[model samples]
Target: MASVKSKAGANNESSPYRESARAGAGSPSLVAGAASLSLNSSRAYALEDFDTIATVGTGTFGRVFLVRDKKSRGFFALKAMKIPDVIRLKQEQHVHNEKEVLTEVNHPFLIKLFWTHHDERFLYMLMDYVPGGELFSYLRSRGRFSNGTGLFYTSEIVCAIEYLHARNIVYRDLKPENILLDHDGHIRLTDFGFAKKLSDRTWTLCGTPEYLAPEVIQSKGHGRAVDWWALGVLIFEMLAGYPPFFDDNPFGIYQKILAGKLEFPRHLDFYVKDLIKKFLVIDRARRLGNMKNGADDVKRHRWFKTVDWDAVPMRRLKPPIVPKVSHEGDTSNFDVYPEDEWKKEPPVPPKDLEIFKNF
Candidate 1:
């Protein structure tokens, strides 16, 4: 969103649903090496090559569809970005950034962008179809998660952030909606729209309000540390049933984040409390991952003492909940979507196709 660099305003309203921070249990998975190569498909897929099964999600820029490959009959999620819509939205650079980041980085915990193709009307992205749906839906259903479940998911997320930071990429957005569950229950962090590769800092005040870091709300230069802050919020919400700081308005939420006030549940463990305190530090320099030791310091914390780091990337840990998808074509996990086409565009000029030629 263009407001990434703008001040917090009424436009940044929180989703009434987003504030529903209760969560459920999940297990961890191992990570893979750096994504240094692009994907090579058997053959390039097209919009007409697949049958649209259903619309899985709608975002500011485009719509995500559950599609079946007619030739192989394999199910995949196709994220479609209409050219004229993106240009009108003024998110050209963000779209390009997402495509570039997806191509360069491949990890077990991160979503795989198989390949991209653009027609005159839209830019098409074929990605792995995560059948378990959003962690948000599961969280809302369970209200809260067990400590083991919370830690399991957090461990994988920690690995994801570690990988991104090592590559100098700051994932500005961290929320349950962006966290998809594989059929086996591992996290597949999706949507790289707000992701930016930065060695120093960028003053973009973008991110879900409840997850936004203090420095971001203050318009001070922020970096990978913002992601750590969001992680703290995520872990807390998973265990406590809600974020540590929340208010009806975005400005109010920002104010609470700046104040750094935290009211933990009395039943919470001291070690978990200590970890949250470490990451929620108002000063980005003092934040756990931002310190000299970086992510290791956070990983080595007492709360994660039982985690087997080596087994993490290998998908060895048994997840508590395996989604009940009987087949690859199951749409039972996703919310029923509206059937609006939003006015499709006819064939465009070559110049229009040039804009997304490399997508």
Candidate 2:
């Protein structure tokens, strides 16, 4: 097995786990170093078969890197996770769950996990590399999206989430940070660490507070319906540059969420306003616009009636703006990883055979 060592010496200022704020309770970096197991697959694996171009992002468990495959010469996002950290935090199940959910899902708007591998120290996931940056940063830079652009992205996310719900998967986390932009600027849903397959229902108080549905905060049993509530909040944020419910105090935000009040800009179009009203309804049973209606309801909304669904998915629509990469090899420009932290490798785990027994 290949040995690993932290590039950052003892006094390095760059903490790879700085993105912990975005991950909340499910940070990937925290779990990266916990598992110390190796797989017994007959197939041989080689790390040097790929070139690490740049660090795209980092989380509690590990960091994601842009790498070029030596064989296929294709670009891919390599997500590394520390095994011991994951087992220590009791998140081994969550990691398995994420892999299972991602394997079962196949949609253009959903990020695709191509392959997975693990060494004694780290588990690596190879995924489609979305060239565009995160949708959240895009929106922040643009102030707010135009109605046409917002509806286009929202409609795609609705389709993706509806597909997950239909498969009995509940995506508890829905936030701008989790939404990645494809090469064409279309929204692609990523990160299923907090997601679970719902056989019945759950009362876990997990998810971004700002995007949480009222039921989620109250610790009430919430199924896929919570996703609907979040969709409404997401759309409002996209249009207004902020979530419908917001307060500096966490308790105040919870109160606003339970109240389910929506305030729209006066100049917003009627169609957009109406869609928000239907989605923001306090009643989850009725919030998604007619219980019988599925994602089609949102797709058929008047605001999106003019959107070319086929074209949007095909990357036909011109993106509002393109990201500025410093150079052809500078994929790191779009990512937030600190360069000073990339000099050393992280520690590798000791080999253990039992780890593969459950997987």
Candidate 3:
């Protein structure tokens, strides 16, 4: 059976993607750097410029569609978010931050945001349409990955994380659901809604419950240390077929994170176990990537000893799971949605259009 893609931000008990407290503005200290990385394209695009192929995924504000450009006939993923829903959900700043961070960064593993535009009713982002679907679907189908396969996927993610940390950008969300595989099976990190460029700490209580770090759970003004913790959880899930911390509710999950106890399966290699232990430390300062040597220490770890740093970003290494994508716009890996899901809601004019002037 083909694996089905999960809903984007449905209100599930464990769905931390739909929850956030106060929305804050980015710090002024990083304004110049953010501006330098701004993406402004001269081409003018409209909603009618593309023909919708399918509703690939849904989010808190709107839906992601697989589309084909009328002029070039090229396939692209058009992310259209309802303006009124975004305003109602208090996600204005997060939308802006996603565009800001995506515009400025360029890495092999990160998704590319081609351009952005907004109308009175919706905000649209044009991006590369990765043919392969979510890594979550693939992981579910396989149950668990082998040590070699898990190492391959996690190594690619480590490179992406290192690049983000170098720029002082914190990718707070790093789960299988947020990662998409390209046709060649290389991972493309998506969903920058929770990502931020921070010079210090941010107090926002957000992110998936199973992946949240101890500092975030305690509301201790978290920074990039949270991502390292998530990475450790990701590594464990990839090998063990489940997260290190699981519970019947979010509160229960937090308790396990605070307790910081890990029970590794006996089959895990000694070096791999040590790597996970260093990453899951409750103290951020003691975390592997947060230490003095920085991400260098993580790359030098025993588990990643065989990784060729030079070849990782270059796509030289062979991928373990090359998706069987037939053409530019293949939706077989994604689940099918109702054809009129986006048409059900009538468009309502946004009252505060000034806030989205830059969009």
Candidate 4:
């Protein structure tokens, strides 16, 4: 890794990406540095500008569509969240938070939100069309990653988590499914529904059961430290092809996490073995990032010795596995979905949409 600097001079590539004038104005302190910051214009986009092709992915409150921008002939992933479902599921706050965070952040490793819109019944978020599919999918196909592959992706994730933490945001969800690979095979951390800008602490019983940190399971307030813990779990899963802690039930998973019982398989590299041990520490204060030097402590470790932090921000390092994307509008990398599940409705504003004015 490049020798750490305190951002005392020009924009540090090792730090967060530089923010544009618009982003800097909104969150001055969080705008550390970036080579090029594509701030969200928040311009109005008509439905006609985009041709929604197919459903690429879905969740409890929304579906992601492969959309082609008619004007630029570019492709994008449009996330459509039904307001009624959000309200019924009591995920309105999460929806708002996701939209707000996505708009503010612009990093190579973080998913960028192009613009957001609403048509009464649904809220729409148009973002980068990452067609390489989920990291989870890649891991599943390969079973596990080589040590070098794990180090490469893990280094990028470290930069991402550090950037979010510097911005006073805590990404509660960090797992393979939420981590998408771009066309170049670099990691793009997505799904900000569980993310929040909490500089201090927050008590939210959220995130995947297997990935939840011990502090979160305890209902004890947690902040950015939880993210580091999740990073540990993610690194372990990527190399081992499974999470360190698991059970048939959520309760059992929580118990394993609280117990902090980690059994390493044989033939693991020394750097990974030591780093995971430090990161999985149950004591939040003693955790990797929570310790004195913070994220730098983790970055400076021997495991990441080969990581070129500056190159990561500029995407100078070529990824190990670039997706075979044939064209700009390629959907071959994504899974196919049934057509019956998609719905088409008018853009008329519902009478009950007053709560979304702020968004």
Which candidate should be chosen as best, given TM-score against the real structure?
Answer: 3
lDDT of 4 by residue, 7-80 (tens): 11111111111110101011011111111123375455655577767666654445667778878888877666
**Between which residue pairs do clashes occur in model 1?**
29-312, 30-312, 30-313, 30-314, 31-313, 35-106
List model 1 lDDT by residue over 1-359, tens digit each: 01111112212322111211011000000112111223645565555667777766655445667778788899887666656656665656777777778778978998777767665566666677778877878888999888998889999999999999999999877877778778899887887767888968887656778898888888889899999999999989988989999998887888899989999998788999999999999988888999999999998999999999878888787777788888987878877656565564655578766676676
Q: Give me the candidate number with maximum lDDT.
A: 3
lDDT at position 329, candidate 4: 66
**Candidate number with the higher lDDT (3 or 4):** 3
TM-score for every candidate vs. truth? 0.87, 0.80, 0.88, 0.86
Model 4 misplaced stretches (Cα beyond 4 Å): 1-39, 341-351
Candidate 3 TM-score, C-alpha based: 0.88
The regions of model 3 sitting more than 4 angstroms off are: 1-42, 341-350
Query: Arrange candidates by lDDT, highest first: which order?
Result: 3, 1, 4, 2
Model 3 misses residue 115 by how many Å? 1.3
Which candidate do you rate higher for TM-score, 1 or 3?
3
| Stretches > 4 Å off in candidate 1 | 1-42, 346-354
Scored against the true structure, residue 332 in model 4 reaches a CA lDDT of: 75
Range of the 10 consecutive residues with the lowest summed lDDT in candidate 3: 26-35
Clashing pairs in 4: 17-33, 17-34, 18-33, 18-34
> What digit string (tens of lDDT, one per residue) describes model 3 on residues 1-359?
01111222212321111111111111101111101111434565555667878767654556667778889899877666666677777778778878889888899899877777665556666677887887888888999888998999989999999999999999988888778889999988887777899979988877788899998888789999899999999999988899999999888988998999999998888888999999999999999999998899999999999999889999887899999899989888776756563443344444576777777
